[model samples]
Every structure is written in C-alpha cells, then in structure tokens.
Target chain A: MQTSTHANPRALRDIEMALERTKAEIPVLTPMVTAFGPLLAERFRLREAASGWVGPLPVVDAERFSQGVFVLADSGFQDMSAHLSEAAHGLLPIMANSFPAMAQELNTLIAAMDNGALTMDALAAAGFGEAFTVPGVNAETMDFAVAELVRPFVERQAQDLAKLVRDLPWRQTICPICGGTPNMSVLRRIRNDSEFIQAHGGRRFLRCSCCATEWTHKRISCPSCGCEEPDELVVLSDPSRPFERADACHRCKTFLLCLDTGELADIPDPDVAALTMLPLAHQARRQGFVPLAEHPWGGL
Target chain B: MPKAIFIDTTRCTACRGCQVACKEWKNFPAVPTKQRGTHQNPPDLTHYNFKLVRFSEHLEGDVVQWYFFPDQCRHCLEPPCKEASTVDGAIIRDDATGAVIYTEKSSKEDLETVRSACPYNIPRQDPVTKRLVKCDMCIDRVRANLLPMCVKSCAMGAMNFGNREDMLKLAGERLEAVKKEFPKASLLNQDDVSVIYLVADLPAKYHEFAVAGVSGSMTRKQMLARIFAPVRKIGQQVRG
Candidate 1:
C-alpha cells in the first residue's frame, strides 16, 4: 500500500519511470528513491494545478536582474505567501511519513499552521531571522519544512520567471529567480549540428534547490565560493559511473553534484536524477565536503 | 515496460562508426585480421567484437546493390538461449531494458546448447575465460538514461533506442514509408525480438541469419514460459 496519495497521474507515472530506471542502474538507491519519490511526486501534483492558482509574476527590473539581484529578493515575494498554508497542509503529513525522525515535529508544525497561530509570513521569515521562537519545534526542522512548503508555489512562479531570465545575463551560481543555491549542475548539450561528435555540453547550468530554476554559470568555476582555479575545483568520477560525478571545490570544502545531460538520451527529472546521485553525494561527503546547496541526501 | 532498439538499415551508410564505438565502449582489444575479401572485418561476431557490420553486395538488375547489416544479439523477447542453459546462474534477462545478459557463470553451462539455441548465432565464448559474451543491449548506458553506444555513435540516424511501444510504432511507420520504394521492405522478427530491424529488401539478400524461422516448432506459449522462467543475474553488477 502506498503511503502518499498522488492526485496527478502523470506526476506519479513520471517518478515511477524514473524510479524504475534509477533502480536498474543503482539497486542501492531503491529504498531512498521509493521513500522520497512519492513525496516529491506530491510536489509534481501540486505543480499541475499551480498555474491556474499561482497567478502572475511581478515585472522584473532588468538592471537588478543582471546585477546578481534575485527575483525573490525584490518586494514581490510576500504576495506568494497566498498559497503557502495549502502547500504546507498537503506536504506535512507525507513528509512526516517520509522522515520518521521529523514526524513528531512536522505534525506539530502542521497543527500550528492549522490553528492560524502560524501565518505564512511567519513561516517564510523563519529561515531569514536569527531569533525565531516556535515553541518545542527546533529552528532547523521548522526551516526545512518551511522551504519544502514554499517550493511548489515558487516553482510555479519560476516557470514564468525562467523565460524572462533566459535572455537576461544572470551568471550567479544561485538561481536568478529564487536565489537558492544549486543542488545539481548539468552540462547542456552542444548547439547546432555537432551532437554526434559527443563533445559533452557547451554550457554549465546550475539548478535551484528551491524552485527548480536553472541559470548558466562558468563551466570552470565552482558554484560555491566563486573558486575558478582549475586545480582547486576538481571533478571526481569513476569511469564505472560515468553519468554522475562531483565538482568538489577544495577552497570552499564543498561540491556540486554534476551530471552531463549531453550524454543522456533524455533530460531526467532533477529530483529523480538526484536520487541516483546519492552515492556520489555520500562519497563527496565522506571526503569532508558538503554540497553547495541543501538536499535530502546532502544532510544524510 | 521493456526497452527496444529499432535499426533502420536503409539509413545506414555502413560507416562502421557504430562498430568502432562498441569496441571503444567495451574497451575490447582489436583483433588482427587479413582482408576477408569483404568489408565485414574479422568476418563475424567474435568474443571481443560483439557487433559486426555484415556486408552483402549483389548484382541487382542494372545496378550493383550493396546491403549493410550491422548485426548483434537480437535480445529475443523470449530468449531460447536462456531456457537452454543447464546452469542456474548463467544467462539472465533484465526485463527493465529487455537485455539478454551473458554472465561469467556461463563458463559452467553446457556452452554448445546455449550457443546453438540462439536463432541469430550471436553468443561467442572467450577462448581464455571460457565465458559467453555478446551485446547486453548496452544496459549500463541505458540504465544511466543514455543511448546505447551503437545508437549514440550512429551519425546517419539509422539506429534508435527507446521503449518497446515507441520502437514498435516507429518500426511500423518506417516499414510503411519504405514499402513505397521497396515493396518487400518489412520489420524482421519484430514480435519476437527487442532488436527490430527495418530491412528495405528481402531478408535473405542481407544475411542468412537476418530473420528467424517463423515456422519453427517452438510455440509462442513455450517461448513465454521460457521467457518468464525466473530469470536472474549471477555476475558483477555492471554500471556505466
């Protein structure tokens, strides 16, 4: 019996397909993929209807966008809080099931959201403020749940924001839209008639941990700590697992999970791809490096 | 769902790019060979060379026609080779990608029966390791969401790899389109194999083993029983 209820069939099917393929390669990831997959699929379900209810985006100032100022850094973020309470309600129970250790805290957080004692603004502010008093619930647990709740809402808006930023030059390793650090980096396929030569990819794009947004970054530079020295930023990969690797920055003591999409038959769902890259994440973490961004596996 | 490969022979230029790519991907050492009077190097699918571009040129009407058949394991939907195995952990079928894999444990199986059971004559044993080897459908790359080496290396758009339903649909579409020029054009053993070939002419003109004998004694039920017979792998869990 499935613990999570997936309202959207397509979302459930996509994750299932991803899970099957991922399991074929790394049977070791079966447990993690099976556990978190449906939880993420719940987000996919939310995304299906988000476009109708997510409303419109605030117009961007070209100057600020190009100068490293994220879209969410602007004053328009408070308006996104409208859908927060619903997203939190939908995810908390399933997340509690997914993370047994966090279950008690998440259930309490759900009750807080339900009673109107915890407003959307308060949840959103919890991550930013130094002093946050959510009685009995630790700050770290609250922040993680808050980010998860905010994900669907921001992802819906980021779909609209991605097109606007596509032509714009936002080179920061973090997302130009949500300012979230990248959990993964993809080497995009080459342009114009040279695909068969298999030159890997032309540009490096960092995917946002928050809203699933992607922005181009320097292929040589580390997304964390702006480390550009080739020796300091090293790529660790075994020929055995060619698809997934880590770009570890010695200077920052952090790394980014890297995948070359140019070699892949299809661009896999980022979350599913991350599940397969769990071993590489653990490998990097064992070498005394943390992920550039927060992810389920990063903490593990 | 099982995965499949659709090979449209008409689009193939016989560049031998796919053949070389397979060798490189597997890191198989090159074999020394004298010119066999044909472009098909080493003459057949050897233990080291799992893929072969079988060349057959015939004088057709006023033109000298050349047919290139790049051949490998058919990865039969119901592999007779697996059923013929005497050893418990020798031949295995990965249902996920429809790959018929030959493991190191195959050295202990009654090698002759396993080799002869394959209609395509694909299985080859290493003289040293005494283990059977063949194209495992590039299962490693497929698992990693990448195209097979042969399909990835094909520059002429001749080879395609995808889900079984998509390949069947594509094979049907290509057969219909190619039939206009070559009326006898058809898909080879598509129903029984994961690797479906779209031939533009008679199957015999290409190669002797291009298609399986449809009138063979084995019933579909028997094949299904053999296919579903608790297949398992007994070697290193290969990855890309």
Candidate 2:
C-alpha cells in the first residue's frame, strides 16, 4: 500500500482527521452486503421506450449502440455516440451536472482516455472510471466513459463546498462557493437513518450555475422558471419508479429530474440512479419541452 | 453581430461540461485520447474538441493557487486570422451572433499563416479536410434562441453568453465583486475581442497566453508587409 506524501502541514492534519473519521465510520458506510441485495430490492425495475418515440431519448436504429443502453468504451467518438440510448445515457448526463466539478473531472478523464493518457485501471483506481458488467464492448465503453466523466465532477464539487462556504447562503440556485451550475435542483437528500442525520446532515439543495447561489428550491416547485404553479408544472413518471419523476415546467418550457429518497434504505447515486426515469424526459422533449438541466453522461 | 463567450475564471471549477456539451450539441465525434498526467485531455484543441478547460496550479506565498482557464477562440474584434487569410469567404463574421466562422474556403489558404496570425493561437486545421476550425460560439443554438450547448451545460457559471451589452454589464458587476476578493482581478481583451476573460489573478497564472501578447516585434520585412499591404492593395485598385 502506498502512502500519500502530503507535505503541507494543514492539509496533512485535515487528511489525518478525515482518515480517523473514515476509520470510525467504516462499519456504517461499508456494511457487508452482497451485490444487488436488499438495497436495490425496493425499486429495481427497467423501463423501455415505446415505438415511434420522438423525444429526448433517441430511437433505436443503426445508432442503437447498445441494447437499451449507450456505451462508449471503444467508441471512437464517445460524446457524439453516447447519447443514442434514450433511457440510459439520456438521463445520466443531466444528473451528472448536479455536480459540476465531477462533470469537469469526467470530461478531463475522457479526454485523457482518448489521448491514451488514462487507462481503465488508473481511472478506476482514482475513482474517475468504471467498467460496466455489461456483455459487449459498446455497453462497457459507454458506461466507462459516462462514469469517467461524472466521478471527478462529483468529488471536486463536494470538496469545493467544504472549503468555500464560510457562512452558507440562504436563497439561490448557484453554488456560492464555486459559481457552477447544478444539474439536479435537489429539494433535499433527506437521510432516513437517524444515525446519519445526527452526523450533521441537513436539508441542503443544489443550484444552477448561471447565477451562483444555492437556495431552498422547494421539492415540488418546478426547477425551471421557479414555477410553483401546479397547473403549469407537469410530473412525468413510469411504473419502474413512481418516487422519481421528471418535473417539466410548461411556463418555462424547461424540465428537472427529482427523486424522493425519503423511501429508500440507502442514499442513491443521483447520476446513475436517475437512469430509470429516462422515458419521461424523452416523452417530455417530444412534447416540445427543453431540459432546463441536462446530464453529462446520458444524452441523446 | 458577431457572437462571443465571456469566461470568468473565478466561477470555473474546472468542470468540462462545456467541452462535452459542445461536442454533444455539435454532434462532433469524440477523438481518441490518452492521459498525459494533466487534467487537460486530448492535450490540445483539435478538430473535435473546441472548448477546453485548461488547468494550471502555482503557489503564491502561503496560498496554493490553482487556476482553471476554459480556453477557446477569442474571435478578435478585427481578426488577424481573417486578415492573414486572403482567400475570399475563408473566415466570416456572422451578422447574427457576431461569430467568426471558418468556412470550407479556408482550406484554400495556408494553414500555417492563418494559425500564426491569431494572437491567441487558436484555429486548428483538420489534417484531412485542410480547413481551419475553432469555437463558433454555438451560432446554430443562438439562432434558435437557445444558449450554446457549452454555455447551457456549464454547471459552473464560468461560461456566460448573451447580448454584448448585457454580458459587458454582467462582466462589470462581476469584476467589481471579484476585485473585493482578488485585488488583481481584471477582464482580458475587453475591447479587442468578443470572448472576454475575467481573470482573478495575473492572466499568465491561469494559462500561457491567457491574454494577447506583444512579446516580440515582427521582423523588418514581415512588419513592412503587414503595414503596407493594405495601402498597396488599395492603391493598385485605384490605379487599375
């Protein structure tokens, strides 16, 4: 095992404290569990696009790079090809934007990979890349690229929040710390576990980047146009997950994806977790709705 | 009306959302790249990657300064690339978005000359097509009343686009606020280019050539040609 050579005294102290915390919390964060266990049992479902669909999700044809999923593993042109899948890649990119720093990291990783500067192993080790257990090269490639682009953006965004916010502001969508846009207009990622809540978890939401400030955008309020009009705000859902829906603001012709995690046993990765709702955005876009926020990994 | 992009480095988190979004929106295919140790992927601007978030980190005293420069074409007010390339319609200024567009006609000109003329060192040529390319400020999206994909996908408020007057106003307000925190904050090429950069530190700290340079004088013959070419062309037409 290699040790980090952080020479800066303050940074080293911070790292030591963080390591202690991680060691103490390991039992909670890494509870022994089988892959695809009780965590996914509550709402593990898949929804496919309908015939003749003309929405945000692309129709399957020569461009159906993967079966119901867009992969960019060996894609010569990863960005251009990744969005072919309506349900998978379509939603991932928008959700990835929820963390701008991660999005940037992912973009760099992708560029590095294309330039042969990054390898699959290096990416996974640094937590900037992932390999899907999917069958074909296309599926794996797409998943790798998506993960590569998203992870760094997420970590860096969180890091910036910790360092930048001296006194967290009240009402705004942009991240005051870094004037970056957030893809998801989070109402709140409420922790159902009382133990976690006691660990300083509170109701904090994400913001869009155009103006840098994070406000309490209401859970039900349309993220686009700040429209609270019930009639103008349309929620689209499928049977796969009733809790998550695409909230489209008719007034602004923009849409936001929202997840109600109050019902989950665990916190979800908003980027990949939002994949189940891809059909809704596809349906909405076909109806002439533009996405107020887009995903970095998933697009079509 | 030529289009432009105003980048405020203070707002950038080195997120490459604009880069990916630009590729996605433009339907440009991804080029194969390898990790070169830096976060900057693909190394340099190519035919595919138009907008790149450049990263540079330095230590100034106790503060470890890490700078993010989202680099692209400056689209100079009076473009030197256009002046260097005499091929008709090679590079044009779009009336709608004020975008400097490089058409197929650019293939007729010498790529080296056009590339050298750019003060910002923008304009990459496709080896196969022999045409120059750079940021077009998402002109198609502008025409449709949609913000450029890069601007829209920017989760960081680093990239801003709008009417020149409005962007300038916003830039001014931001500059004032940034100055309170960074006394050295200043706008780059505010008057000479469409793409204005509001840098929080010395521009060089952000990226090499983050601002236009007057580092060297042109050679006597080259300088004379540039200075007298316009007058001579006009005189020849008048005499003819």
Can you give the TM-score per candidate against the true fold?
Answer: 0.72, 0.45
Docking class of 1: incorrect
lDDT of 2 by residue, B1-240 (tens): 345677878877776888888788778898988888889886878888888888887988998878888889877776777766656688898876677889998877666767777767788988899888888877765654446777666555566776676678788988998899899999987877788899998988887778877423443333444665466446644664
Stretch of 10 with least lDDT, candidate 2 chain A: A42-51
Off by more than 4 A, model 2: A1-300, B1-3, B214-240
Summarize candidate 1's per-residue lDDT along A38-59 as a digit string, tens digits: 6778878777667522446567
Instruction: Find the candidate with the highest lDDT and give its number.
Output: 1
User: What are the per-residue Cα lDDT tens digits for candidate 1 across B1-240?
Assistant: 688989989888888988999999999999989987888897999988999999999998899999999999999887888887756668899977889998888987655657667777788899998998999988888866788999878866678777798789988988898899899998988888999999998999999989875633454534653554344222222210
| B70 Cα displacement, candidate 1 (Å) | 2.1
Provide per-model DockQ scores.
0.22, 0.01
> C-alpha displacement of A159 in model 2, angstroms?
41
Ten-residue region with minimum lDDT total, candidate 2 chain B:
B215-224
The stretch of ten residues in a row with the least summed lDDT in candidate 1 chain B is: B231-240
